[model samples]
Target: MGDEAGTANQGAPNAGVSKSVSVRELVNRLKLEVIVGEEALDRPIRRSKVHRPGLEFAGYYDFFPIEHVQVLGKKEITYLHKLTHQERDERIGNVVKYHPPCFVVTWNQDGLEYLTAHCRKEGIPLLRTPQTTTEFMMLADGYLMKQLAPEIQVHGVCVTVAGTGILLRGRSGIGKSETALALIRRGHRLVADDAVVLKKVNPQVLLGTHNGTTREFLALRSVGLMNVVRVYGRGAFQDETRIVLDIELVPWKENELYNDLQLEPQTSEYMGVRVPCIQIPLQPGRDVAALIEAAAHNWYLQTQGYSAADEFMRRLQQQ
Candidate 1:
């Protein structure tokens, strides 16, 4: 989760201020400053490296402010030199071409007057830090500050058991837990909930899960909170999952435009990964557990080159 090798002893002042943010959001704030002290950039901003401020810590920053990048003064910035004009031009090109940075950062204490004037002219937010690069990175990583791809919860567990990953996604309060509980009861393992962290392990492989604890936990509205690990034992908690198939649960609607009762399951798209999805609409009295088992069974069949949806469509073609 974070770098805990050493702690920041008698740390310097902190520059962070508060603004409501997720880990993903914080990384975006830092990256906005294309020009960070090279030494600072070399380190990280995750939580592990950065310790809480004190004699052994740098103290706490409220949070990152609206101004994205935090700048370190030259006295504060060491091991970083002025970028060559050519390098500056190239970096600037990248910045303008892809994403506009909020401001410039530097390591020159003497250059503060110059930086101030330039920032004012450019109208970008500016920040100063004294804790140096290494500490900043440790802190950032510990905070879980990393950019995220678009996230969507698939309706079920994506297991690596057979190599084809499955994603289970459903609306809030739709008994996703209840269904997952049944799957686990049937010997299927648990993965993540509320949010799933996915990384591009490779082109064909993706790692998905809640940080080990998220899966072994469930939140139920009617009965209050329950413990998955205590109730189901350690077999229920999975370290991670491979993503392949995504199942989405939708509530059944009588509205003609809102309903799709076709036997064929529809496909949904996200972050360029296309997955076979089962659209199970919720009803007051429907067998959800049976439906999910059937979906997994259906997925297994698809792996073996048999598709119930295709067969249903083929029958219509013949008719």
Candidate 2:
């Protein structure tokens, strides 16, 4: 039996997959200058939270998050300047002894002999950034969070119809790609064609993107694989979008009961995140693309506290 959400309880595939971003990746992506410890660029940054190490600099190390990337900003640098050389060396040593993934000095602050010495000795990567403390922290944290987020690859087509992100899921040769093509011709944007990578950005958000290699191509059963961007122009393709709905296309079965009225909500789970789902029965001469477009518009209305079903019921009662 299914749960109240109308989805069968199933284990999430690749839900517990461990993910990390290497210091080298961070440096290249963020354009950070490598000051020292180039040999340690392969160090893995598993945690998303970038540590400021303010307390550690003040000679307190209790409950320190040693696994995170340590960031030294303008405030921390100014604080170190007031301390004696010996005090600064001791405090910096105490923190670097843990051998955190890396150390980032923000705002291009100078006079880091003590910090660099310890980082070199411990073989911890020391990086420099021109952005301010808060700015760099936000960038690094966001990048790390996305890189380390739990992700699962789904065999489906993802598109944006009327600004709503929709994931079309069905078996092979079930017209998933064809419907997506139709939607694209109707001015909708295709995010991913064959394989959609869904990442759990947070508890309430699931972001979907295309598989890197196949992002620019779409496969149609009628025709062969075509480059969507080259054929349809760049406006019809999007790199990623927040998945708000899932549409499952199933073959029309004789004597099978289907929901005619979408009064109750249905959802499908991926990586512990539930997304609204609609199961559409496939039949001859059915305009599945039109149905999906309407569904996207209806979802937008529901978000604005307007339900067509409820309004219809009210009209019937008045009559």
Candidate 3:
């Protein structure tokens, strides 16, 4: 499906950069109630890790991550209630002095007058939610991770063949789009065409999606731009996919060697994550689309602990 809101921006300076999420965005996304410092909702959340200030409430502030969103649950609130007024004020005051992005009170825990007062004085956002501490932390952490993840723009075509995500990379006019269209006709789904936005969501996962305004649209040289959803229906498109394989197309050279056996696996790194890679030579008579489909199937087999090249070698040794 085409996403008008998720349109890719080719000229954006921050397209591939790590981004910060505003406390206002978080508040709206999580449906949190603004307890105090409504004006401070513009504060930026730079870290994805949520913190529970139990130690801070106990008057221990060593190695505190003030940039993280602080959470106050039943345990922390109960302990704070046990403390004297001066002790509670001093502890909360010490935390608010650092001016964290925000403080979120979870499980509808009340008795936050001290927290609200300190936050209002320091212009720090104080938010409340009905979700439990664990649930809220998980939701907030997941949202922050996706928003603050490192991303990069790649010039290629991304498609899902069978069940694997494949990225087609090559120079201009190398038939990347044409191959993707062919794959779509073969019951595959197109993730993105032209420019692909790759986000490193974690240490081991790189997500691929269409870059602004170009989602579900494919450019086929002489055929011009075609809306994939209009031509192939909704089943032929996907919003995003986890990239697992990269296949680079190059013009066939008579003297150059090619990996016909595919005995040695290749990999390409994007934003610090490496994905399985292969290079295919383009020729006038070669069916590049079918080759890509085969590659995808082979990738799936490898993931299932079956390698065709290894099997071929084992058979050869037996012969």
Best by TM-score: 2
Residue 292's lDDT within candidate 1 is 68
How does each model score on lDDT?
0.48, 0.87, 0.85
My TM-score estimates for the predictions, one after another, are: 0.46, 0.92, 0.87
Q: How close is candidate 2 to the true structure, as a TM-score?
A: 0.92
Clashes of each: 40, 0, 5
- Sort all candidates by lDDT, best to worst: 2, 3, 1
Report the candidate with higher TM-score, 2 versus 3.
Answer: 2
Per-residue lDDT of candidate 3, residues 257-290 (tens digit): 7656754666777756778777788989899999
lDDT of 1 by residue, 1-319 (tens): 0011001111221225222233224435444332333222322222222222111112223442322333343322222235554543443333222212233333323444443444444443344434345555454443442222223333333433333355666556777777767766766666675556554333455556674455567666687666667988887667676666666667787863644435454554443444455666788888876776766666788779987667888999999
Candidate 2: tens digits of C-alpha lDDT, residues 218-315: 89875899888898899889989999988888899989877677446778887778889878889999999999999999999999999999998899
**Runs in model 1 lying further than 4 Å from the true structure:** 1-165, 212-215, 255-265, 309-319
TM-score of 3: 0.87
Q: What local lDDT does model 1 show for residue 144?
A: 42
Which residues of candidate 3, in runs, are more than 4 Å off?
1-18, 256-259
